[model samples]
Target: MKNIKASMLAISLAFLFIACSGKVQTNKIPNETKYYLPKGVKTSDKVALDSKELQSYSLALEKFFKRNVKADEEKKQDIYQTGIERGYFQ
Candidate 1:
């Protein structure tokens, strides 16, 4: 009984909030999801990136792209190997 009342109140509040906003919602979404700012907030000079920005981006990413990782072979020690060697398998 208590849960039903609480849910009905919540739904009514949500409908009231939506009714207060008079703006029409659209289904279309922008192809570019962002503009250098956090949360994709709109800015004036964020239309497109030129050659200078591209050059700076490449320079910044050069070190990260050049990294190489080498892994050495570790001995294959299974779980049963330890128990058998310690005379606990019996």
Candidate 2:
């Protein structure tokens, strides 16, 4: 029947839409590391963080730490902090 064909078409379209509407995971490190070093600087075990890399790494670490601390503060309860505050005598 035409109604059965239409229902099957609708179901197939719905599934196709759902399958295509997914987030694509990318290799973020490849992009981040592309220009991280100076030009002509070959990456190897001998490669070290230049001043720029050092500064960027420091800032990135500081931001990461701050974000984690802010998240902990926003949480209703942090068991580790709670235990440290109540169980430890200092």
Candidate 3:
């Protein structure tokens, strides 16, 4: 009885760990050709932008795409603050 209970417990933990480690992939748009990069003052994609241009583009992408214009989490990129990076929003 003791051995059976221990084996079941181990199996449960293994299953739990596997479920938690799995990453959930949501439907995401990788590329958008409909909207091209809007013209704006060229700034460091490294530094975040607080200017009107950045705000305009960011809001437009978010409002239409329903995705926050942020950097690639896995790539360690910043908004640069272009808000639009890696064609993530492109």
| Model 2 local distance difference test score | 0.81
Model 2 clash pairs? none
Q: What lDDT does model 1 reach?
A: 0.78
Candidate 1 lDDT, 56-84, residue by residue in tens: 99988996776553322245557798789
Tens digit per residue, CA lDDT, model 2, 1-90:
999999999999999999999768785546654566578887566756689989999999999777766677688676777778797745
What is the Cα-based lDDT of residue 60 in candidate 2? 94
Which regions of candidate 2 are displaced past 4 Å?
34-90
After aligning candidate 1 to the native by TM-score, how far in Å is the CA of 33 from where it should be?
A: 38
TM-score of 2: 0.31
Stretch of 10 with least lDDT, candidate 2: 27-36
Number of the predicted model whose lDDT against the real structure is largest: 2
